[model samples]
Target: MKKITLLLLFPVLLIAQEKATTANTAQSGRYDTNKFSQMYDLLATPNMFRTASGAPGPAYYQQQADYKMDIELDDKNAKLHGSETVTYYNNSPDSLEYLWVQLDQNQMAKDSQTPLAESEKMEQTFPPSNFADKFLKKELERGFVIEHVKDAKGAPLSYTINHTMMRINLASPLKPGTSISFAIKWWYNINNYQTEGGRSGYELFEKEGNRLYVIAQFYPRMAVYNDVEGWQNMQFWGGGEFALPFGNFDVNITVPADHVMEATGELTNRSEVFTAAQLKRYELAQKTFDKPVIIVTQQEAEIAEKGFSDKKKTWKFSAKNVRDFGIATSRKFIYDAMAVQLNDKVVMAASVYPKEANPLWEETSTRTVAHTLKSYSAHTFDYPYPKAVSVSAADQGMEYPMICWNFGRPDENGNTSEQIKNAMIGVVIHEVGHNFFPMIVNSDERQWTWMDEGLNSFMEYMAEVELGTNFPSRRGPARKIVPYMSGDQKFLEPIMSNSEGIIQFGNNAYAKPATGLNILRETIMGRELFDHAFKVYANRWKFKHPTPEDFFRTMEDASGVDLDWFFRGWFYSTDVVDIGISNVKQYYVTETPTQELKNSRVKKGRFDLEKGPFVYLVEEDNKELRARDKKALKIEDVTLLAEYVATVSDTEKDAFKTPKYFYQVTYNKPGGMLMPILVAITYEDDTVENFKYPAQIWRKNNQNAVKVYATEKAIKKIQLDPELETADIDLTNNTWPKESLKSKFD
Candidate 1:
């Protein structure tokens, strides 16, 4: 690949790469800053619950929290009411006296502390709805009301509310293998996602007098209880997402009679909710593998939107082994679905959108959903759920169990650009691909956002590429993350940093990790090895909670590749790759050895200077400004070579390849991170040859690495990371005859 970068001409934007030195270089007592050091100090000690191999240990146990809920939508009042019975199972060995429940909705409460954590600034523009929600309206009547908290017998249970978390005081010590059940009732006003801003809420189609509700984190939920962190009771400060345990769900949601809804599970009352024509189309969708089947056509949806039904209908859904729940309900929804076959199983790719989403959504939504499931499945593991649904909502893209909400709206005039179309398709793929990551693999996003978002983004990149050729993906390329990784150090944070502490959330949490994995797959570890290990991890921890170490360990253990250097360099610290070829010297196969080689021979007592076979040659500086003969030197031209050849055995003669050319290449590492050295050797014939030197090349030498290349053909030019796969920050020093920069205007 040709070198292409705007930095070539823009010298002011470029800064000299600060060299990364080894810990051994320190004069006296010092901290261990070895980039290749084991992550023993940072990783938790392996125990019965989590093993060193990165797979779940023999005694691994995760608590389960089952939920049975009754939910209702008061569209007129813009409120959501819910009552739920949470059954906690003590799968862990330890007994518990209290359980923590997360009231995520509290982030939007009138007295929410979330607003105080952020530093806000005034923007230049706002729509009427934004202004109304900002000033004209009273404080949003947000957060859960907590109408009551009762035991299975309906007796009130003692519970205390502290910000977004609720502590349920147990009547007795819940012993191991035992279970307890309790109920809670709550209600709260839903925000308009476009105006108030949130992952989930309503999108108003004011002219049509209807609203589309895409809701999650709308009810009180149980927190995760595991061996790693007994109770993941991290406060929902808004930046940190949720941490929940996996269990079954039985929910009944009531919405207007004219509305169509999809939730986290299979709709049990499809017969009662769907019209005859809709039922027929759904059956066809199950068999339609080529394209989407329109379950609710735009005409029908438009007719239904006009009828604000006074009555309500209940949508019954049941799900198994899911960490969380979500629902999208609206009378203005145009529903479509298609069947996708994965191995022996069949899954549905579904979508729901309003007319405003038009032309764009209808063309790509469900297809992108299908493509994502297939791509993620092929890369990771099979899609475990029965269906993956995409719901269209403006300005929001959030994932749930089997469903997620996406944003991609064309203009009111139904006009869309290539950018808009591609973005919408990419968002749908990303949101739907989340199912394979945190949804099934079950990583705690509240503690480490990259564990989910970053991994999902990487998978999303693959899926988007698999979806089409030359796709304009925003992440997962090693070179794409160079700007952020090489930017101001103070403004950057390591990929392992906590969710709320990150300075560049998107670049740090999503792009960096994705690019790191890409580097591992494409450059460090070959695809076959990397893919097998990645799939092993997904299969090992499916439906279980996995920590960052679990993923790190599994990847190494399964691939039989030691990635301590990579994980430590890329994740634990903010490091940039800046390896380049500083110089290259060519040597002829003369019997006269260089002074450095003669010194090594003297040390071994092999310097026979008084022997009859003495051959001496003079040296010439390569700075003579002349090119050399492009052919191998004949053994007859140098008497010492003929004498040596006659003395060596025929077997050794073949190995010598006499009269060969040798080039000593010097590579200097100025960046903090170490990467596999990829050298592209351009021969005099203009034929390009590439060789990769593993990152271990720098193990003995902390700074500069020297490797001698012997070839039958003369070399023309030498370059490092010719394909830009290592995310090297400096390209100026990469070539042997260092490449010069020229402005385009010149």
Candidate 2:
């Protein structure tokens, strides 16, 4: 009761302290420092391009860049040559003088400046191969070698090459409704992915003398032009990924005659390229749903890889409204496909892997792809593409529009550990799930990695659960992120940080945001509300670029919840949650008012007790020293109690038994973050009572929140956050009358 009375007087004390601090500091500008205040200043100003409701406004516009490419892969030389025709359409309000093209392959150039960004140094421990590649191995002739740039009229067009980006000088200003067309020719050497470690490269099977190529960013592509940033000209720094415009693609790829190929778009020349036997299997696969139909079997692939073909064949593909394109080709591939139904649409889920990937890839790859599409489509939108492909590439997981490369290979005997199986399933779901994120919903990964990786990872977590029973997902649990959130604060950054500058990129971009969204779904907003709101954001931004502010606004706008406090604490600051029960005490009825509470209430005239004659409360404890004081005046001797008892009629005496117990509990937050207080009260009878105080409980008092309970049964213990739903960092102080911690050694 002593602690409770003084806590009631905190307002006067805070005012006095604030005045003293204000006078000493001489700082006068007023600001909304309250955690529950609306964060209007921190948000971008709403405009016609992006509305306050998080949907695209009436005047919103996005630029489009269509491509027609002829690409050839030289197997012996390990080089790629391409000639592309790009048509740029200006859908924006402003006219453009020049167009920016992305030369992403230049990142592998010998003169690439990417390494200078990190000022990399040799580590203490390294593999012999990595050491050799760093110090002894000669630099390869990689990156694009531009031969010519020609306009639509066959005249040479002037262009400037800057490391990973090219600026095409237009003959005249391209108006809002006009379009421009140009052509470019280039070639570059590909890297060995296993030893080099990158997004796209060739994996050499030395034992068989064959190579599997997974290619992306192979051509000079167009950069994004939008209303928000005008021109997203950020260079390809390897860490920060791409920001591109959406358009149609028509590509023709030339490869060895026996090679099997899978790419981002539908294969228009499949009948012309596939054998008569293969064509029959492919048609059956389109109607198959339960299991995959194998087009190229292991026995056939084994014979094809033994000898190289002298002639070449060109495979043609066509895609509509896709942001990017990718291709995977190898003579050693075993191909399979199955149909997946999403509402009325049936998408082809396909896989391409060598015999080395069995039985892991053969057992799970295509199935995982089907499950991810269903789970994500249930939450976001339907899969818009004709097909999605997953290819086996060791030591890498990278996603393009409809095609992605993953790592999953068994030992020589075709057996795998539980760890490898789970890893394979999780990575497949994550990469294939990317099709729903930046591939279709289209966020700028170069600027905000979390919008794609984080959102996709969250959806991936859900898909993993639907794909397998008791799946071992790596993220999306509140408790799993505690270690990273509680780690050295100097190395952590806010989730809104720039992609390249982010510290602990995986946890910051992939895990932390996923965990926060899970908390919102499970604890804050509940599943029904969070699900509907999340779906709204997906439907609004599909095939368009969305920013961080758009997501923040859409969530609150759809959920009918003021989540400014959450966004401010979790996304804007490096704050951790640490809420606990500070203290608990029991009290009894008293005839006279305690001097402390009397002083606070009488002076302020603010006491508003529900029960009558609630003058005071005296704390009680079982101590020898308090025996005399307890015997001096029993609670029955209090005149107020006796008078109330006498006034009650005999018939109502049973109906109104006097309250025998009163307990006051106080909760305190040591960390900077604010969260709802979840409490569980245990009684001597072993029954428990659960109570939840919404996050607004701290609106008036940010440091401490107090509650009073009157119960018939005595409470044995009180615990805060019994389920650990808020990602609280410290658990040692979570219980009042704290028990001794017991570890395994104990």
Candidate 3:
């Protein structure tokens, strides 16, 4: 009887196998040609200046610009004036005919093109103050006023000004491997930053009749000159930030004797600037790692605010190898400082805020700075600078070299909300983390904002999470960016867009790329590989400018993985991820040739009814033949199968695992993005098994992919992306037995 069954099934099996082989071989030449190709066209070709290995090659060179400035702030007049002497070094391989300086404050000029470039629309409702500022108030005569341009000999030099940029023509061409010295004296009216939103300026306290100044981009600066874009003298449009060269700064700032100030560098004359008690506290702060020491008490600040000292004090600072300079000064600032150990270095974490900022800023600001440095250093490189300062300025969040201004103030009654507290902490971390990014790594912010802002934001999220589980981080999660990514493509811009061209600045320049890196760390590359590669990038580009290619190549080079597809999909395109299980089928194996197999054989005309070893059941037609076949094929009468089982070894019998169930699951990609497929299968025995398919599974057929599973238990249900790891736009089709949806009317 066993022989009869085997003989009857042979012909049908052979015919099915032949048909499958023929179908598979029919479309031999039709294949996806770009499944695993390198990103040659999309990437810049590797050259001597910047190698394909993502490191600066032997011939790589960068220009340098150093500055010595004397600045004065007229608190009563709300104005700032500076006279800077710049010593420019031509380190590049090309000769320099002239030097370009960036007047970033010119964007606020009354006749500046920045305001004209903005398209205003009449809204249905507007705030009274906003309406007045927009329609009724006269434009302020803002921007830089250059007094004179002179050479080292004090003789006037030829200069030209085109809006925000100034060209200083040298008497003789500044040859390669040479240095030139020039001087510029300029001043500009400081705008009311609270009324006019900008990266720098002063915010007034109407009740106190005083001002708190948070200043940056306040002086004429040299633009970046590198292999990518020689002399990146891009206009300082209001949205996109500056692109300055790394240099040492010796700045002398003059302010009221009673006012406290914090700048980019260490104070050269701490003894002359601080009182005896404040100096004692400042000394103690260097050893106080666990908590902060108050340098200037709130009572002292309040008393100083009322003095309005006529005498001026010179607070000298000297910073080394920094991109730009910034200062925050006000008599109302209550100063605090603490020490944090980052690896082997003990760095100061400090904050300068008004009494209104406590007890929130007092508790969190400096702590956030310290935490940011630790978290960022753990993932990238250590904090190379001596100090990180956070100054509380209303409606301000901006980062310079070692100092940054943050916004988070309590109500007039010293009351604060959880949201406000989190915002303060989040912004502080973000700004301090920037010290590791463009401040040190020194990427070109004018050309690629993401290279600085996006990376810093990603580091900020990590620091926030390290703060605690419940920390309210605004970005860095895969799911947090889905709303923006899956929104109307018309309003959405790719992450690779220019800083000025992005529609949603915060979401595009900060959140999306950060989220992409978070996804890379948590899902695609895993934390170990991603962190190592990220550290390599941070160290490799420290104090040097790196383009997008340097970051992309270094990540792959360090991780030994090809990530071109990831970069292309996440950065270069506005594609959303939506992978789902389209269909699922389950089958069980049987020894007998069932009616389906018999019909397949009959259709192909490959089986005969009288063939030897024939097996049949009473369920089919022809009652007489069915009865005879069933009687001959009865289990007890199968002597050939019994003999074979008796002859088989126990070990061989144990090795056989006849799978009880087989599943063919098909995954469909409704969205035009590629991601790994994560599946979880639940069986009848209440057990679960997870399967992870690499992103390459969809390389051949991007729209749909099928995977087969052989299991011991019957599959009850299948779930895709069970952990919500992927940013799948749609969840409706992500289950084998589709989830039921009810209509709104129902």
Candidate 4:
């Protein structure tokens, strides 16, 4: 008889185990609940606001500027000379009194205020410089000088010159919403940006006597005027980026015939610059997607190295719908190209680095660029430009529209470390990806760094993962962010801080927002939904100035998700995540015994005669229901209990049920942010159950919450939020039945 009973129990255990496994599987898959839900909410919310509010949209404003620049690079003296005519278009609503031109390289001049001002910021997040004086005091600072300013008609205009900035006063006030034409002559001293500690220009490599030129902010350009920030007057103080109005750039760069050059525009004169074989290969590259073909081959570069050409050829490029322009040119450049098909359009992905940047650069840099194009195109719109270039520099990584400068160098023996390789690939992918972010998305880096930086960084993380089969990414994943998320509370700041002054500035401004977006894509919002909504935002505001509200509204409008809480918590507040499973109570119920003895006791004055007969006595001496009793109790002993339960009609059957066991679980939220609670229940038979509560479960109770479960099996253990992907800063209190019992040492 005992063997037969055990056999019957085995089937029940099997059934319980099956249900438990299914529940645990479901629980483990529910991640990033808050992010996607918020994305959904953001998509659902409607907007009545008329104008867009951020930096991105203005950068997309349509305008065209035709530039005729005659530039000369002096390798001997480390200086540059140029004269240019600009046909500027005023596409904004407000009128302009004078056009502003950026003399970006002038920041390296002795008189520039940037180094002095930035050096005073001792609490900067990145490298701080006390050696500014030594760098600035160096002779031949190689800064730009603006000599003349004139209209298309040759009449001179009054202009003011400051270090790295030149203001050209217009002869006549150009009214709002109109185009103006002008020209200027300028030259600049070129200092080594890598070792000399400036934002733009180049660094001197030890062996070749060759300088890597990552020339940007090189031309005089117009300032932006929009609803947000009125005029982005934030001066460039070393590390901050740019804010400029959108326009076309028709530039002609003159480098030695042997030098390989790439810039921010379409190569209109490729036949004049590239050999017949190279041009043929360039045409073939459009059809080749598997790998890159060499444009300026290693053999060709070595041959060019043997003999320097004095004869120069002008490479003309015309870029439409670009906000900024930059160029990189050197005889030392080794060039390779790959093609990426986006929306069926063949976009070229190129890499150019010196011999010092080879081996590692040859492997990852080109592939990383190709990966970025594919991933970003899926998340945003297709690549609009014909080419995206990544050039290797030694110092800082900065972005332009068609080209960007990245930092990564091999060791002395042509050996590169993995960290260096990853950093180089990551930076290259990041900067090239920025062409889609602020370059075309047109967010104002001067006002809201996250609008472009955060968004681009988010894409960079995704691109990195997609580039390699098992890429070890440093940011974006939930587990990867725990150290940063759990840092000292005093150092933490919300991602919505003003661009100019932010504490823990890099974390608050870049990493957090990027992580938040990653959480949205992987955990909160599933890829399909997030990708669609993001692509919609990109397409909707492709050539327009998009404010934060525009992004917030568009995301919701497209995805039909309400995301106000997400924007409020992640972007607006420095909320930590510290939710805990507070408590769990288990109980079982059975029928009360009959009261024949109670009546007899009442007559003996041991019971209250006025009390109801169905009353369950609280006496601890009740023998029928002992403390050690494990048997299921019966309801027949109490006739009144049976009648009470029988009184429920068919209509009330839904509310009336027999539950042998009961559990009350309490959850607590010690952090400012709210995330979904994932609960796992394990039974005595090695069975498990899982339940999920939305982030809104804590809306009414920020400190703690309560939940009750009814089950027949005994609960063995309970766990809360098992996966570490939520970026929960604290994990010690996550499990119920606390495991840590510290021993007190005297």
lDDT of 2 by residue, 242-303 (tens): 99899999999999999999998999999988999999999999999998889989998899
Residues 464-528, model 1: lDDT tens digits = 77765789999998889998988999999989999999989999999999999998988889999
Mind sharing the TM-score for model 1? 0.92
lDDT of 3 at 174: 88
Of the two candidates 2 and 4, the one with more favorable lDDT, higher being better, is: 2
The candidate 3 region of ten consecutive residues with least summed lDDT is 2-11
Question: lDDT of each model, Cα atoms only?
Answer: 0.87, 0.87, 0.84, 0.71
Question: How many backbone clashes does every candidate have?
Answer: 0, 0, 3, 36
RMSD in Å for all candidates: 7.3, 4.4, 5.1, 10.2
Task: Score candidate 4 by lDDT.
Answer: 0.71
User: On residues 1-746, what C-alpha lDDT tens digit does candidate 4 reach at each position?
Assistant: 11110101100111112236455464536555443344443322332323222123323344445566767777656777788888776665667677666666666666778656653534444333535544444466456666888877888888887665567777677775677777788887776775566656777765666666888877776666565545555666655577776776777777777788889889998899999988998887777899887778777877776566878778888888888888898888888888888876888899888877778888878888888888888878888988999988887789898899899889879898878888888898889989888888876776778888888888888888877557667667776666777888787777766675666666767778888887777656668877888888888767555667777766666676666776767887778777787776553332343253334433334234354343232222334544533233244443555565566667775675554455677898877776777788888898888887777776655678888676667677888766665778777788877867354462
Report the lDDT of model 1 for residue 205: 83
* Over 4 Å off, model 3: 1-35, 593-658, 741-746
Q: What is the lDDT of residue 166 in candidate 2?
A: 94
All candidates: TM-score: 0.92, 0.92, 0.90, 0.82
Which residue pairs in candidate 2 have backbone atoms (N, alpha carbon, C) closer than 3 angstroms, thus clashing? none
| Off by more than 4 A, model 1 | 1-33, 121-137, 589-605, 611-619, 622-632, 647-660, 742-746
Which residues of candidate 2, in runs, are more than 4 Å off? Answer: 1-30, 123-128, 592-615, 621-660, 742-746
TM-score of 3: 0.90
Candidate 4 regions with alpha-carbon error over 4 angstroms: 1-66, 118-142, 161-166, 591-660, 685-688, 741-746
Per-residue accuracy of model 3 over 1-746 as CA lDDT, tens digit each: 32223423122343544546465565647643453456776788889999998999998988888899999999999989899999999998888888889988888887689878889877978899888998899888888999999999999999998788998887788888999988999888998888887898998988878899999989999988888878888887888787888889999999999899999998999999999999999999999999989999999999999899999999999999999999999999999999999878999999999988988988889988888889998988889899999999988889998899998889988899988988988889988888888999988888789999999999898888888758877899887888888889998888888888989899999998999999889888999999999999999999898999999999999998788888888888888999988877543333344565556555455455435344322222332333333322323344544455456679976885644455667899998878889899898887999998988998788799988776777788899888877788787888878887575598
Q: What's the lDDT for residue 330 in model 3?
A: 97
By TM-score, is 2 or 3 better? 2
